[model samples]
Target: MESAFSGHIYRQNGQGVTSILSRRVEGRLMWKQRIIGLHLRSKIDHSYLSQSQHADTKGKSVETALHSLVGHIEKANQYGDFTMVAFMDIEGAFNNVDPMADVEAL
Candidate 1:
């Protein structure tokens, strides 16, 4: 169920152009992302990221999240505290990205 972009570039004239990237360029981009992920992981706390988003975090699923939530809810109930949860579905969350900004930040 992995979704990937087909590297298609669209023009103002409504023409679609397929951009083919060489393996070398693709590998370099992947390596850069992996390095960035490693650096971020070292600087940030692991708990701040969703388990599935990182590489080192394995054997974690939605069930694990639910179990943790239920345990916290039970503890809160024992202490007479209220628990609330919010869910958000954002469409096209990753569809827009400025590559120049990312390169500059790096």
Candidate 2:
């Protein structure tokens, strides 16, 4: 098993202003003929930290969420059973995600 953490910077505005920061930590395990990969991300949450009283609150929330997700993935990796394969593909991971629509009468 191997794990790595990486940081990335992106320019949000057209004027080359880069204000947002993000990071990702990935873990992988190779067994026989297959590999299992897990990715965790850190993103800036502006909603909870905009006000003076809420400063640092967003960081705490994101940290907790990432911790919980990583724990769950670790548990699954320890208990899940599977056979080794030569190839794997993640289909419709990003493009298929849809936001919930309010279809009822408003």
Candidate 3:
């Protein structure tokens, strides 16, 4: 995904065009590098989690706890098979996900 543009002029009259071209090239390179890094990190994280015995046990425990909690809630609220559900949304959730910025700040 890396993109770059270069222009050579016989004279110095095309400074504006050169500047714009370099900026665009650099921007594309930055985006491509970011995407590659993200993909690599994701793959590494998935590998680590998949190979970890502790993660598997933790996941099972979490699922069991959630099932127990739901069962308890259902028993406590016996309304003839009718149940209620609540959902909440947080605004600017993605805006808070600056992983690099957070690492740099830390």
Candidate 4:
């Protein structure tokens, strides 16, 4: 069986609103996740990004990425062979694919 997570909530004094969706992992899971995070971080390809991908590093926001992408597209258009630029964000798409849907609908 897999481990489960617990949710935590916190709020300030005199405030009626509370923060939800905060997770506090157990001790065992925390250690396990740390080890996994270290391994994954080490395996990242530092050279996979080219000079054109200026905002593709860690901690980059979507706004910065859009700025970089727009600049690159504009530069490419000057060559007279550019058609269109397609963008896809596939990070969390797997969860939203709805795998439980009826297969026959395909």
* Pairs in clash, predicted candidate 3: none
- Residue-wise lDDT of candidate 4 within 1-106, one digit each (tens)? 7548455566665756555433233555557655655655466566866645544357667777778777877888887657586766688653344432422232
- Local distance difference test, each candidate: 0.63, 0.40, 0.55, 0.58
> Considering summed lDDT, which 10 consecutive residues are worst modelled in model 1?
10-19
Model 1: per-residue lDDT, tens digit, 1-106? 7648555454343455433455456788778767765764465566776643523555766677678778889999999999998756577553345544554565
Between prediction 2 and prediction 4, the one with superior lDDT is 4
TM-score head-to-head 3 vs 4, winner: 4
The best candidate by lDDT is 1
Better of 2 and 3 by TM-score: 3
lDDT of 2 by residue, 1-106 (tens): 5546345556667776563433222212123112111111123334534343321353456557556556766777788944332433468653343322211211
RMSD of each: 10.4, 20.3, 12.3, 9.3
Model 1, TM vs. native: 0.39
Residue pairs in clash, model 4: none
lDDT of model number 4: 0.58
Clashes of each: 0, 0, 0, 0
